[model samples]
Target: MSKATKTIHAAMAAHVSSALDALQAAGTLPEGIERGNVTVEPTRDPAHGDLATNAAMVLAKPAKTNPRALAESLAEELRKVDAIDSVEIAGPGFINLRLSDNAWRDELRAIAALGETYGRSTVGEGTRVNVEYVSANPTGPMHMGHCRGAVVGDALAGLLEFAGHDVTREYYVNDAGSQVDTLARSAHLRYREAHGQDIGDIPEGYYPGEYLKPVGEAARERFGDTYLEATESEWLPVFRGFAVERMIELIKADLALLGIEHDLFASEAELQAAGKPEAAEAWLREHDLVYDGELEAPKGKTLDDWEPVELPLFRATRFGDDQDRPIRKSDGSWTYFGADLAYHFQKAENADALIDIWGADHSGTVKRIKAAVAALTEGSGRNVPFDVKLVQMVQLLRDGEPVKMSKRSGQFVTLADVVREVGKDVVRFTMLTRKPDAQMEFDFAKVVEASKDNPVFYVQYAHARIASTLRKATAAGVAPSADGLDRLGEEELALVKVAAQFPRIVESAAAAREPHRIAFYLQDLAAAFHAFWNLGNDRPEMRILVEDDAEITSARLFLAERIGQVVRNGLAILGVEAVDEL
Candidate 1:
């Protein structure tokens, strides 16, 4: 196979698989043995070997032999391959293989050959995946509360695409909720104020953001006092639609500052208007998945104050949820879960998989929604995949002090404000430093600090240093060349090995739906390159661009160029720019 077609780990896995096939053909092992459980990956400790495999352990039982006996046979077949420098059978049955120097050198050439397209994989096999995120209620502008989810979802989509999945970036617009009603009422106050009427301070239960002033002004400009004195029923629907439209526009603009654009914007109001929820309800009822049932009262409410009510309930508990969930209120209105269930069912119709990025506060609703999707899809015998990833809130701070909310947004710090203060790359890279579900603190002072403690700066500086070295080398007429790659030493080869892990990282991160793994891997790769650079401080011979010899300089420059390429690729997955200079 061509170098561009497979990852280093994948190549090693194929070698093991070939050895197993040879064993079966020789009658040393049973035919048709399941190889799905076999795995070949980098060893946890580099001292063990370049790669380790569980092939022997996985096949020993089927072969009716001891693990050590099977490993001995496997090692014999593996030794026939030219690339295997040594194959060691560790405890029980683990087979560890160390490759020749030519293997690592060839990988460096592959890296330089692939360039920006490196680290991409076809592991997803073109499965259509729907990623819905940042479905914040369209009641206000984008705030810090919604920032993390937006970044995570966008990065995950990028990662999936890199892994060769047909991904759809979607945003579920929550325009049918009661919050829009509050938004319309708030817009009316601002509208009345725009008409020279003294609307008093924002009343309770109304949005108080000064950001809504533009919406009010737009409403005045369009309506021109046509509904100034109309009844609430006459103007409520008009303002609701108008406010939702304006807020969605504001949200898209705010998201643009962070380079996030969704491919589709699904509307809750439209779904209800098209009777999707009713359709889902009818399907559930026909399949005995839902029925008229009464639910227990509030967990902490007194029994005397609790009123028993009968409502249509879904069998969420049967699918691992805590309790049966109500799909509609007793008054015959669809509940939030009802609308959300129908929305996910609609999403599943066009995609093979679904992923939702929700805030940590929505953790309680996760099980119910997962159950709904399971029932909806499994009942139809489709078995579509679904995942709900919860992202925790970010605590904004400056110089170790908790930052105050933005007066413009009224309730929280706006995402645009933070992006403007530090930059889109800093916000994005910092949000990915820690896992999404873990608590994160975005310190205005710390993220921009030019030190090793700051991962964003450290990783970017590594790429910048490599870029600077390449530029200076070219200035002296030492262009990177693959001809001198054979002259490189173990340290240079070690850097290539680290960079070669990018493909595996991308595939694993996409499979796990955790894009932060790419962030973590970049930091490690950056550290390795930085350590190699520091080697030159005491040993002049270890420097990349040596004055006496052009051959070694070309070899090291080639290594540095590829290292920079890997850094840029990893940063690209996180939607961060790889700066050429600090």
Candidate 2:
């Protein structure tokens, strides 16, 4: 936790303890009031006071005393505390405490002492967490929609790790599906082209991207004309394996372009290898969650050949699914849901928490997956917690014009394309400027603009401005050490106080799985720093690196340096660059 949070907690505890003592002495309360229920939080309205508590209002009825009387009594008791400068009883007997400037000034010292480690926490207690994200089908390159999930998942994992979780970043490879078969066909066409064959038009229902030409050529080089004479059974597996491997390699390169690295690459095919599907089916059967049934037709999509046919189905409805879902097709091949169940079962054995970062398209699949987990665990779901975060789509634009993306035409803008165009730092920061559930608009032109309107540039500028101040301080012979911080002015003290809140911000954002909160907090911090910087222009005495006074200059420099460190640390967690001289 940050120094501000610690101070808040400590001060609030003392105040509450004193109030309890007063109540006990007056014999106006029950034997044991839960002091833990009392909380101290920054008042939403700054005019109200620095900190506000509803403790008296909460304890009034139970203590058989009027809330105002109790608040007055608590106020009298809290006035004895050293940290609080004054106390007032507000509306409904709410207690508002105004703290001494020193209490706020001490935050700067705490921030300087902790440095970059100021915001780090141990709340997660080392629980193992598996974060699976961007499990995009390896059929083609990643697009704008994929960027949001990648950034959110990566930031969340970083946040959790900072909060003391044993996080494992994973990518689930969907290699066993029919989409890969299309990829193989596409690669086969490319292979024919590579072999000097006029494989004119990309076949219908096959991938048509020019990217596969190289994979096709590689395949031809590995197996020349051999697959031409082979039967479908003999060549499909070979071609599928080759295509899948090449696609995975390309996907990895694309992810690297965005600075994403996965510790685990789980394969759906591997889950079904050596008759694992049958084993999974058997396990379900033993648990009585599987049976032969006919599924209802989907509500929206039309199925012309739909017929009532008995097939293997999971009793998903029993565990909260909307209806029983098919586990096997009419041809007896495992359905996608069946494969997914087996995959999740495998995951349950390895992780204490399963966090799947999926695009909004898969929102409907969430409930059934949860139901399957419940079925697989047979009511012992405590060992595995499933959290599915649906990342909304990103609408890309340039100069107010939509960047049309069509997957069928193989002309969709890829993640690598965006990174190359705008740089990874810009891409990562812009992707997180909004909440994950909200649709985001990524305007190529606006993101690169070096203005306050662009959040990335704004935050980076704050850090750079601090660097400029530090340089100015050193040039002016101001000692950049903590020993001189005792002379810090109110402006410098305010900046320090803001910096001290970073630890608390980190803890709250990590606990909420809201990395966007970090971005918001950084923006606020930057705004505070900028406001202070502008004050220097208006009042020379407010400048951080004051000249002709060694002690005051040193104190100001320490505060400026601490602000830069905090900006860098917060940006690092969000995977954004902290340019020292931008």
Candidate 3:
């Protein structure tokens, strides 16, 4: 109901809504009918029309009429709009519409007028969202294992911000977990190595990455052999705090390589020290969501040491989980679920919605965490939207062979090294070329290849081509002008039709919380532009820059400039730079 700048599709839907309202007021249709199902989208086949709507089909049954009969009435109302050239009722009461030439020209002007902010929408207005992503444990430098989620989270945050949501980008630091203890032990070995001790062959349980050497060196520099001969208890806390801090610094640097920066780094250690988990548990107990219960052993498998023990359990089964989940261990330590539930509770205190981008490896735990959030929020009489997006691991390949270890990190390929080999834009764009949950292979050779098969290169090439055309036109004594846009033909208008879908794409992508939709949309726009550009191969006049006619040349250049703007806007959302020249 709140109006912002309208996309072509939105505008068409609004027209249908208005027509329905008029029909209701005139007693032709029933009043108080739900119109939620009405939708407008681009027609699949070009021969049919430009846009199609299912308003009649969606509202027909509710209006006490058949679909075809309602479609005829709706088509009559739609045909009266000046922008619609013709309306045709298709199979099953779907109505397709072709727009007048002036309508496409108007959209081109809107693109130029809106410039970089063309695709922005206010549909998510007045909502504040918390987006937590790439909370890789603070035990080591980020590798390919963390790269996909990092990019996906950052891109989704950007997409939501573009769609008019107030977004907080956060990274939850797992400093309280056992992994950081392993990190401290690992750094201790390196610290000894730094102090002229031959600490050979990092032991099996400790981190082996050479990246921790710097942390050890820094520890030695700060403590100056103070803890070299101390007891584990005396030095454990000191080294644990020191190593976690240093690892966070390293993590920040690695994230920077991919153009990601978090607004907050919520620490699990600090959260525990603040007694948030205890508070959450107390609250859950008060609401009867938590109870002391005995749980069965692992399903489908048995351990000789396994025994039923009473623990504080969350009744997650009541909220669609497979079974009740334990919040505490026999030793009275909080489980990962306990700490994560408290963390999400903390996040929900200040945001209207919560989204976490996690690696698919954590897929099993998603249900329990979601159930906890739902229990805490809904039980407190507040409704907070929550979503968990799982990003699959990226299989790094070089020339069709699996890429193994990074000599720098000593375990897996570091994200920084990959970014160094291929630029940040290439890495970021390539990660998004597939859906987040679908398995994918990141081929260094394939991503850098200068061919249509490479989406990153292909989309960039389209923008570069448009830039080149604009420069050539300027050198040829012509400038982009809207004056001659009316002289454009069907081919040029078709490109505009594709570009005009940007606003709709932004809203839908933001609504779905899928940033890859923007990437996919850009690919389609790039393909359309390239196909139009290829027309110049056979007919010289079909080119963007014609030597003889300055009038049409300026018009075409204007069109190209707008397309480049759209590409830039889309790239900006993905944290990929839109290069004027590749």
Candidate 4:
């Protein structure tokens, strides 16, 4: 890495480390205080300082000193650093430090040198993470409920990879469930119709989507009436396999429209065939985590078939769930929870951490799954971190009114429909405009509108405007450089300081597993860039491309280019395109 391209936080952190070393050498502070607790971040109120930290507070207990006292000593050592202009101790021992204008200028130069690689981090340390998302049942196509999870999960995996993780994107197929049985039956009716048999009226419990017609035709062509006289048991498995394969292809094609592809697809049928769920249950039984018990009827809901029966149950209450969960049903078949627990156990075998992105309808399932992970990991004498992120529903809107939706496979607003309506970038960016757990409105009109009200357009416009500046500067034989970077005035320097926070933003956002933070940060950075450009409107001297004063113009262009670089990098992590022109 070029010395000029060191991140601003890295540079400040080095100074902090050295200052701690100096204190340790002088015997003023202990030698082995944990420095991982130390952090350097930009303050929200610029009036307080350029950057702030709670290091003194974090270390005071370890150093056997009050926070304010520790801050005073730390300030004395910090002021010796050349980058710092002044240091002050705020209430409760927050240390705020202002850096010289040269620090921000050097940051701009670093960004210009590093370009797209500027904001990438090494915080993840190459730990393996398995991210499972959009595991929509292979019985149908991906619908509106699946879109948010797909985009969020993909973006999060990208963020973790950019932060130096070994990430595997995976999908778990529920092809072994009763849903697929119903799907196979539905395809059977269609298959008969394809063979010129009079089959009418899709029964109530079977899938009625017209998309299965193609699957039926394919089956008839492949088998040629061989299954026409077969028993129900003989044909059920055959048709189930055929229909599942076709639906998975359709699901994959829909995912491709949004630029999503899973690195692995785990089938529930295969896991069941391999006896994973049975093995997990046997292990839990040996550990006394599983038992034969009868469960109470669910609260606020009536079960008409509430006959009490002994079932294999997991002791979930020990791990903080409100109730012990049943893992096996009366007929000895594993429940959905049982299959899911086994799937997660398989994921935990290869990953140090596991993340599942599910629609909010599964929020209640989270606690039980986490409980199972705890019990299963305890059996292995290894603890793995498992997190389930619930993505809420997206209410589709057109213009100002709500758009009606269908849940049927062929009738729903498929992921492809939205991606086709607006561009993929728009759909992806709009999905992340809100937090994953918050209900959001996917407005077709607003997303495609070319205005500041549309965040995708606003942020993309910033990058495109910078591209225009670069083209103009190139035609006029000008380029960004630090030779006369000191010519930048206070407002320009202030903006550069904000631009330098890109690395910090990335680290914090990735650590929190919230890629939405990147979206919001890019919007803020874009607003700053546009405001800087507007200043040139009222004052001719502040214009970026001053042919007469080439040195000042070079400094301005250098700042603009760096801001553009940050915006581009941020958009890349969110899986959105940083268009050259919007």
Among these predicted structures, which one has the highest TM-score? 1
Q: How far does residue 295 in candidate 3 sit from its true spot (Å)?
A: 0.8
> What order do candidates take by lDDT, descending?
1, 3, 4, 2
Q: What tens-digit string does per-residue lDDT give for candidate 1 at 134-191?
A: 9999998899889999999999999999999999999999889888899999998888
After TM-score superposition, the amount by which residue 447's alpha carbon in candidate 4 deviates from its true location, in angstroms, is 0.7
Looking at model 3, which ten-residue stretch has the lowest summed lDDT? 1-10
- Scored against the true structure, residue 90 in model 2 reaches a CA lDDT of 91
> What TM-score goes with each of the models?
0.98, 0.90, 0.96, 0.96
Overall local distance difference test of candidate 4 = 0.88
Between candidates 2 and 4, the lDDT winner: 4
What is the C-alpha local distance difference test score of candidate 2? 0.81
After superposition on all C-alphas, the RMSD of every candidate to the true structure, in Å, is 1.5, 3.3, 2.0, 1.9
Query: Residue pairs in steric clash, candidate 3?
Result: none
The positional error of residue 252 in candidate 4, measured at the CA in angstroms, is 1.0
Q: How well is each residue in 1-582 modelled by candidate 3, as lDDT tens digits?
A: 223344566778788888888888877789899988888888999899999999888988888898998888888888888889999999989999999998888888888888888999888985999999999889888888999999999999999999999999999999998888888899888999999999977787788887888988999999999999998888889999999999899999999999999999999999999999999999999999999999988777577767889999999998999999999989999999999999999999999999999989899999999999999999988889899999998898899999876543367788898999999999999999999999999998998999999999999999999988888877888999999988999999999999999999999999999999999999999999999999999999999889899999999999999999999999999999988787
Q: Where's the lowest-lDDT run of ten residues in candidate 4?
A: 405-414
Better of 1 and 3 by TM-score: 1
lDDT of 4 by residue, 191-300 (tens): 99899998877777778787888988999999999988888899999999999999999999999988898999999999999999999999999999999998997676
Q: Which prediction has more favorable lDDT, 1 or 2?
A: 1
